[model samples]
Target: MWKKTQPLSHEDIVAIYDVLLGRRPESESVIENYRRMGSAAAVVRAIGQSGEFAGRRMSSPFHHYHASFDAQEVMRRHAAPRLEPRDGHLTNFLGVVIHSKFLPGILGDRAGQVEDIPIPANWHADIAEWGAALRAVELARDSFTMAELGCGWGCWMNNTGVAARRLGLKPHLIGVEGDPGHIAFAREACASNGFAEDEVTLFHGIAAAAPGTALFPRQKTSGMEWGLEPIFNATEEERRRALAAGSHDELPMIPLDEVIGDRERLDLLHVDIQGGEADLVDSCIDVLSRRVAYMVIGTHSRQIEGRLMDSLLGAGWNLEMERPAIIRLSEGAPLTLVDGVQGWRNTAR
Candidate 1:
């Protein structure tokens, strides 16, 4: 074991990178750079900021390991909170201010008080998503532009926008949501965070491969609804049955091209459209490769994740980070219990 007070040897530095970052150093010079840092703690701190470390944190099976690198601890060490939390409003580890009304069914009782919220826990989002989103913002030059597909309450949009703004870059946020009520919440979130009207634009529709109509759930209890995906290319009988069931609403399907519009470059594109994620991405791979700088996707199943890899890797995009979907045997078949996350960077751009 290496002592914290002593300078790490070359072997110790290599081991630390392998264990913490899941990879060896790029070159001997890289190891020498860490060696110059002297202490093991400094090396660990530097590794913690790396994209590989972020990926490893997301993919770790142990919850405690993930919690150790929580945003709260990171913020306390590096960046200070931009706004103080009040009774009805709370700031996350990233200094993004969120209103309590947006918490409701999401955070449950923890949303009641600002003090009750656990900053160390991944209550709303995982570390990989935060890392990928922030990495995109860090890569932005003059301005930061991002779009969130299936943007429930505009969570990623507001979170990333605030992060970019904190870095002194102007943010242009775009959000698309099938649920009208959720769109309203997203609008409220932007306003509550003090974003100018021109800085934020919201679309009330579904994001898909093509322009058409799809069936989306008209959720009665909007607060309790999540992971809702639109059903596309439904037959007449299926549409009739769905309408008769009184659960789904026919909504306009906005294609990726329309959603992208004339933006020169999008800093980030966050997608979490349930199981439809892979298909939507595959259909828009060409456009995405040219326009998007980075993507943080929510994967629902092993199959969806595989499809994404094939499509994106073929398109020359680099898989910067990934946390595979958690699969468990259920009645002699594999079923995904929790959603996985993947962060891709556009190498072509």
Candidate 2:
């Protein structure tokens, strides 16, 4: 049976480490650090700084263990020897080496199905079109500041970063994510991929209309929804229920007005906040219209698609490229196409 784990206290951490290291902790020092930091994350940091934990990098044991467990489970269920970890990484259906947990055939049940088609291959033409659109918006020749909201695991960031670097553009990348698990994985990936901490700044929070805490849907039914829309704009009733039930967690929500700040120009803003991009964009029209030079948005619904098109068009932005909306099918074929990933360039600015 799955048992709920309790929060670890100062004494618990000290006692656990005492047993592991076979030595007693300096009680006064441990208590002082605990009081100063006042969180499990801080306790982990303190442990990393100690002589015993030297060279250990502060990587969470929970993260590694969970990744391993998920990988093994996926491999076993799918009976996919090819999907097994090779050289310490799983080459997913997209041919992208994912160093984290992955679920095989999550795209579809049968091999060679439309969903089984690797993403990079299936979207190769669209990718070219997207690049062309970016070039048309004058991103090809200039250094730019790019921001990605809901940047899960930094895949899009890595792709864009490499492209920007190849173009001799000094890309200032900022990623905003709501999931703590993703935040940690992205940070590790950035480090492993040789990205300087200063080059790619990441904030562990959801993008919304304001900078504050809000109740988020912490319980997920699958991994696909990990970086999906968070319920930051919850109703009073929903908030009350969440608070009473204590099943969900509240996370920091940052506004785009605050993210863009006093910067004279924002070269590109890629929004893939699951289904919440409309709310985020709608909330910061003034800043987005005046400062953002280009944008790529992933619309989750026709309503969201219409709203984005109307908003950007009203703001004097030109639509460069777009995919039309798609409907789901319950028959012989899968709904392989979706009308999302629209591109726009601000011409008025």
Candidate 3:
């Protein structure tokens, strides 16, 4: 619905920076320079072609394939030893082997199949998530440290860690999940991928604003449940009742600050904690800005996406890429059909 020929206004120019560059203008002079372009479309073109923007794009591991989704070319550039197709393991395009037992819900269908180099469409994640997570690894120095909250079988950790290892960088991975079964899966996945015990840590808990306990639903079927969120603020008696009822288990809640520990630099923080992502990120903005270099968050709603933009951008984080949540009309209100994805970079880091 955006008009290309619309005359640029002061507010519109500011929004251009927020939407395109993911930050506020440096000064009035910068806005003035953009205003001289006269049309919104011209300003957009200028920003999109700028070296800063181009540099950000080039940082992604998928940079070469962005222009053309040529999966073969990408595999050729970043190939590992071709993995043998097996019944319980599937190799991704990056040659990272994944365990079939960790595939959740419909993703389990991929089990026991021979996986060729996958195009972006066939991949589990969209381009933005793939680019963001891998970009964090690409930007690492001699060492790469990453943590994943709500990490299902440590998928991102293993994938990104392998990418970092390929570049000769030492990788330290951390995974936190509410499900104990998934935590076991994470441990198995990491070990299978050749990470030493000292290089990997798995936590059976939830990431929250503070340390506490939350009620997480006990999954009856392993690998069949996904998107399970913990119920915060449950009383001790309620948690006991739920536990006795065989429906939920009390999980330790660890704050982001404690999760990262004394790590001087965390290359990536991947979060997909269902609908609680915004609040968790907002509460840990200071830690995020100081320690974490990049983030790829799975947003559950449009409101969550907006809150994330407001909180992170307000704290000087750049919006590297984003795909808004898919919404559909429902009886009560609008419902999110599919979760949105947002990739953020902390400029202060």
Model 3 poorest ten-residue lDDT run? 60-69
- Each prediction's TM-score versus the true structure: 0.76, 0.61, 0.76
- C-alpha lDDT score of every prediction, in listed order: 0.71, 0.54, 0.73
Highest-scoring model, lDDT: 3
- Tens digit per residue, CA lDDT, model 1, 1-349: 0112234578777766765666789999999977765444345545654567666664443132222134333333424444466556666665555665654533334442333222212445544556656777777888999999988778889878887888899999999999888888899889887799999988889998788999998878664456666788899999999999998999899888788789889989998887888888888888898899989888888899899999999899888767666444546775554466788889877
Candidate rank order under lDDT:
3, 1, 2
Estimate the overall C-alpha local distance difference test score of candidate 2. 0.54
Candidate 1: count of backbone clashes, pairs at least 3 residues apart or interchain: 0
lDDT per residue for candidate 2 within 143-261, as digits (tens), equals 66777787766655654554465456776667887766676667765665556787787887887778888765564432334434466668888888987897666788878876666
Please report the TM-score between candidate 1 and the true structure.
0.76
lDDT of 1: 0.71
Candidate 3, residue 118: the lDDT equals 34
Badly placed stretches (over 4 Å) of model 3 are 1-83, 104-109, 112-114
lDDT by residue for model 3 (1-349), tens? 0112234567767766765567898899888877765544345545654667555643322222222233234434555655666567777766677776665323355665555443332335645566667777776888999999988788888989988899999999999998888888888888988999999988888998799888988987656455676899988788779999989988899888888999899999999887888998888888889899999898888899999989999999888767676444556665553456787888877
